[model samples]
Target chain A: DVKVTQSSRYLVKRTGEKVFLECVQDMDHENMFWYRQDPGLGLRLIYFSYDVKMKEKGDIPEGYSVSREKKERFSLILESASTNQTSMYLCASSLSWGDLEQYFGPGTRLTVT
Target chain B: EDKVVQSPLSLVVHEGDTVTLNCSYEVTNFRSLLWYKQEKKAPTFLFMLTSSGIEKKSGRLSSILDKKELFSILNITATQTGDSAIYLCAVESAGAQKLVFGQGTRLTINP
Candidate 1:
């Protein structure tokens, strides 16, 4: 059984504030991803990390950045949060690029007011 | 660009009924197709289909992929109220680490 845990389940922040969402996986997976899910939009990738200090931008990477200083932890950062940034953020990790099964963490619902 | 589309955006069914969800994709360098069940929390893995015509089953839920048609179908038999959830279909492309996801089909099962 793989376990993926997020730092917060819900968060509220004022406009222009900085926000951080953290995710950690116990399976020692090499691939980690960040996605934002919205109604009618599905899950849009924000960012992904293949290895420590290696990051790649997904389809919707604007207004967001990610950090992967260690293999087990991945952090999503909103340099300056805005109301439009409010969304349900999800984190996932997979054993490898070819391994398609991605274990997801309970999402963090962020509210930017 | 890799695109995954799920049909019948939403469906309502009663207990003991059978439901089928459809997913179609147009992806470059196709690798595999996956199914997920999403409730209020995170999405859980259901099945992963790599070859065509091979049905993958787990209890009442089963799925089959069609590589030639670039599509897949998920079927649930004897559906129960607990089976209500958003069914998601995703495709992994070769040489890519991320999976392209569909908008998902929301299923509602009434007791």
Candidate 2:
């Protein structure tokens, strides 16, 4: 079975602290994605990468950035955490560009205090 | 803006009852629609529909997509408490390789 692993399951950080969320996929999927899920707004795409070192901004990428230094690993960086930034973060990966079904990680719940 | 919407934000049913969840999307260059079941942890993949009029089924769960109407429906028969979860609908468009998801329908099955 394919597994996508996130570094942390639960995290708490200060409002202005810098935070990092990590994800690694066992499968050699070329595409990786990061999304933040909220109660009423659903899941909003934050960033994604199709190839190593190639990252693209999604709809809600304003306060987030991503790094794909390795093919199997993708990281989401929050320059400065805020109260509003607290949410459940999910990581996903797919084999190809048009393949819509993505394998997702267990998700990291970040709480900004 | 591309959007996905799910109906009946929440539903309650008995173990032997059948339930249907709805999802609608408005996106540019629609590629496909997907359904996922999210429990306490991550959401698990259920079905992916690219063509209209064809139904996909797995045991007690079945789904069908209608491209012309830009909507899909997921039906669950013989509901069980273990089947209780948040059902999410997402759409993949041509512009980006990302999936836009709906708010989801939270289903609760009573014993």
How good is the docking of model 2, as DockQ?
Answer: 0.85
TM-score of 2: 0.98
**Candidate 1 lDDT over residue span A32-98, tens digit each:** 9999999887899999999999999999999999999999999999999999999999999999867
Which pairs clash inside model 1?
none
Per-residue lDDT tens digits for candidate 2, residues A23-97, read 999999999999999998888999999999999999999889899999999999999999999999999999987
Worst 10 residues of 1 chain A by lDDT: A94-103
lDDT per residue, candidate 1, B1-111, as tens digits? 899999889999999999999999999999899999999899999999999999999999999999999999999999999999999999999888789999999999999
**Cα interface RMSD of each candidate:** 0.8, 0.8
Displacement of the residue A25 alpha carbon in candidate 2, Å: 0.4
Off by over 4 Å in 1: none
